[model samples]
Target: MPLFDTHCHLDDPRFADDRAAVIERAIAAGVERMTTIGCADTPDAVGRALDIAKAAPERITATVGVHPHDASKLDDALFAALEAAAHDPLVVAIGETGLDYHYDHSPRPAQQAALRRQIALARAVGKPLVIHTRSAPEDTLAILRDERARDVGGIIHCFSEDAPFAKAALDLGFVSSFSGIATFRSAEAVREAARALPSDAILVETDAPYLAPIPHRGRRNEPAYVEHTAALLARERGEAREAFDAATFANALRVYGLA
Candidate 1:
């Protein structure tokens, strides 16, 4: 059952009190690696994961860029800092960035502009983009096409349940990632997409602190829960969990350039 979480927000305040304990618990649960994203507060005040990665440099990995809700924070100061900080080896990806029309948290234009800038920076820095798209798939893909994001390459993070959208993204050479949504009773399409990916094309994320799986539905998710989704995916493919995990983890590492 050894596996990787692929995505999480150990920085979120919920983990602040016993974050180390949580990581230890996950490790004991056989979760091997986790990506701590850059979509946090101001660069200086990012939470424990980045702080730990900075101090230890290997226990966790991280990405750079602002989340849509925080797009306004991608101002010059944050942009400049992200550019400088992204060079760190601990940082392997450049986003969690993209459009989020569901919440319409930030102005759509602002999210679009930030997405473009982060894409450019990711290309310049030679890191994979950690994309986050929701309810704005058309424009999200549109912007990526317009910005020529294929040159940089990245994942369609926490992918939409729509396989037509999955096919469209895969056609662009982007990896499709599934989160716990795949385990939802109502997410047959998402589950099927996970099963249908061609060899070396699928990845899974917890989107942790959110979207926990069936047994833990509506609960706060963490990296260890990735295995549950992995189990379901493996079952769908009629393969053993370990082999499926190996393939999916390899796909994620390849996508994020962890190798």
Candidate 2:
């Protein structure tokens, strides 16, 4: 089955020692393509993901933005760098940017400001967005609306919200990309949301180096493990695994404008 891990952090320190091996494993496991997010907290580091993508352009693409956790660092210089990087041919999207109230790593105001700016950046560059929202659904949706993010659309990476949130996001032109969290027993709301979404509005990801799925729940995650999340979604929706995989792969391509 072909798969697309629509989100991951291939540049993360965890993958530093074996990034090539990890990509090899993903391809061996049927991940045909993956998007490595470029979340720079500093201006100088903005090109990290682009460098990775450039090395394997056919199999990898990248998104550039400052993560919500480091929203405070998105100053004029970094934003300028992000704007320049956003125009790179290998860059398919403009974020992993949005609100993260769970950590409040940056203040709520800063997160919101960063999200608004990135949404505008996405519109400016004619690329979709890669939103990372957690525990701030109302505010997240409000900001997206206020910023007119629907103009460029995007993916809600690692969707942890419910059906209503999914529906709301879809209305704003954002598709929900489910991650390993969907496979957890306690994530009933996520499962329900997965079941309820239209096939085209749903995509799957590993969000690797983080939410590894069941049976591999406690282990370090990589692109190869995205299949477990896809399997869980297929079973939840009572769809054939092959069909689900194909649909999600195509959805990722469509959302990223790769198709």
Candidate 3:
């Protein structure tokens, strides 16, 4: 079955030395397409993400937006850069942006402001969004609704919320994406959340260099291992692995506007 890693950070420094090899492995493992997120963790992350997509245009695409952690840095210059990046041919969406109250790396207010701006950017650009909400579901949902995000739709990347949150996002035309977290013993609730969503609203990712699935847990992640999460998600949803994989792949394409 062909797979699609709907969200990943291929621009992360961990893959700098051998990014090409990583892509090869993903393709070998049946991942046909991958969307590399351009979360503005650093000032130049968005540009770097587009560079990575340019390196392998046929199999990769990118998104451009500031991440919640970097919310404080979303200055006028950065917003201008992001707006310009949004028009890049390789850019498929606008974000990896949203609220992250867990770390509070950037204050809550800043994250919310950044999220609203990015939501507007996504709508203005006529592209979808790639949201990163954590520990702030209520605020996230409020902002999404307030910003009328349903107009462009998007994916709630690396989702870990329960059914109610999934329902809320689904109501806004957003889909829930699963990551290696879905394979964790402690992530039973996450799997349940995956089960709760309709098949077409499900997408999978590795969020690589981060949450690698079991058997490779605690180790660095990469796109090839998305299959493990896909396997778990398929079983939890009581669907065939091949069908689940194909459906999620198509879901990613549809959300990213590639379909």
Candidate 4:
């Protein structure tokens, strides 16, 4: 079955030495398409993922944003660049932006401010969003609502929350995208959420170079390992692997507006 890795960091330095090989392996392993997230740490680097997507436009798309960790760096110049990049055909979404209170790499206020601005940008550009919420569920949901992000909808990428959270996001037009965390032994809550989510509201990702699934848990992650996370979700939800894969692949295309 073909799979879609809805969220990944193909631009990460870890893949610099063999990025093409990584993409080849992903294709060989059945990942037909992937969205590489662009988290610009500086004003000038905003189009990093778009450059990668340009090379493989048929199979890859990109999202551009200021990650909450780098929220404080999102000055006017960076936001303007993000505004321009959002108009690119290869750029399908407007984030990977949201609250990340867990690390506080950027102050909570700055993160919230950045998130609101990106939501507006997503609405303005007529694209969906790719949200990254960590340890700030209430605030994350609140900002999404306050900013009227439902106008554009989005994906709650790397979902690590519970069933209630998934339902809440779904109510606002955002779907849940699972990562390798779904395959971990200690993530019962995530598994429960996965099982409870409607098939149409689900997606799978590797978050490459970060969360690698079991049997390859300690190794560097790549898009190829998304199959493991999909398999786990299928088993947990009592659906056939082919059916589950097809649903997620289609769902990703739909949310990213490629459908």
Give the TM-scores of the predictions, in the order they appear: 0.94, 0.99, 0.98, 0.99
- What lDDT would each prediction earn against the true structure? 0.81, 0.94, 0.91, 0.95
Comparing candidate 3 with candidate 4, which one achieves the higher TM-score?
4
Please give the lDDT score for candidate 4.
Answer: 0.95
The deviation in Å at residue 238 for candidate 4 is 0.3
Clashes of each: 0, 0, 0, 0
Q: How do the residues 78-186 of candidate 2 rate in per-residue lDDT, one tens digit apiece?
A: 9999999999889999988999999999999999999999998999999999999999999999998998999999999999999999999999999999999998999
RMSD vs true structure, all candidates: 1.6, 0.6, 1.0, 0.6
Candidate 4 residue runs with Cα over 4 Å from true position? none
Which runs of model 2 end up more than 4 angstroms from their true locations?
Answer: none
Specify the poorest-scoring 10-residue window by lDDT in model 4. 41-50
* RMSD in angstroms between candidate 4 and the native structure over all alpha carbons: 0.6
What is the C-alpha lDDT profile of model 1 across 1-259, one tens digit per residue? Answer: 4677778888888888987888888788777778877685476643334566675455588887789888877778788878887888888888889999999889999999999999899889888888899899899888888887888788888876587777777776678888888888888888777767786878888888889988999888888788788888889889877888888878877887776
Q: What tens-digit string does per-residue lDDT give for candidate 4 at 120-182?
A: 999999999999999999998998899899999999999999999999999999999999999
